[model samples]
Target: MQVLFGYNTNGGQSVQSYGYYDPNYANDIRTVMVAVVAQSHVQTPQQDAPTKLQLIPAVPASQSITGESLPAVYFYPPAGSHNAQFTVMTTTVPVMNMIWH
Candidate 1:
């Protein structure tokens, strides 16, 4: 799993996600991509920007297919005034767990 964050040409935020796979595995190929956006609001002037990345693990009950452990990620803004966005991409056999900042 790999992630990248940067500013777009129009001064907006951009997120790029990439997944790596082993060459040995010819049939086992899968990718799970997750993105979370925290929209900025003008009415909430007192709201402080998040300083850290948050990763919330999925419980058994929250799993998409009964036993799968899907993750929920929160990627905050680079600057306080801009909206926050993040992308999570994974390509592994049986979908391995990924924890990154």
Candidate 2:
């Protein structure tokens, strides 16, 4: 599986980060999971740890066709944050896991 990350800055005060996943298999996939963690890039260690951002599943399990080229899922992180990371994992099988920092 391959995961892609992007960000949009036009809507509000906070920047929005999006995650895209591609299983690259012909068969439909329903067990893929996407997660995002955002941390404020503060200069000091006293800052809080990364927070779990809310993920909005773009496609349902039934409609997650591999070749559609659209994002199987997407997420929006907290606004005005920095140092975002993304993780992709498969729940059903032992496929490779991915993490982006």
The digit string of per-residue lDDT tens for model 1 on 1-100 reads 2321211122222222222223432123233343445453443445554565553333342323223344544555566543333333342222322311
Candidate 2 structure quality by residue, lDDT tens digits, 48-67? 32444334445433333332
- Compared with the true structure, all predictions reach lDDT values of 0.35, 0.35
Error (Å) of candidate 2 at residue 35 is: 5.9
For model 2, the stretches where C-alpha displacement exceeds 4 angstroms are 1-71, 93-101
Which has the greatest TM-score? 1
Q: How many clashing residue pairs appear in each of the predictions shown?
A: 0, 0
| TM-score per candidate | 0.30, 0.22
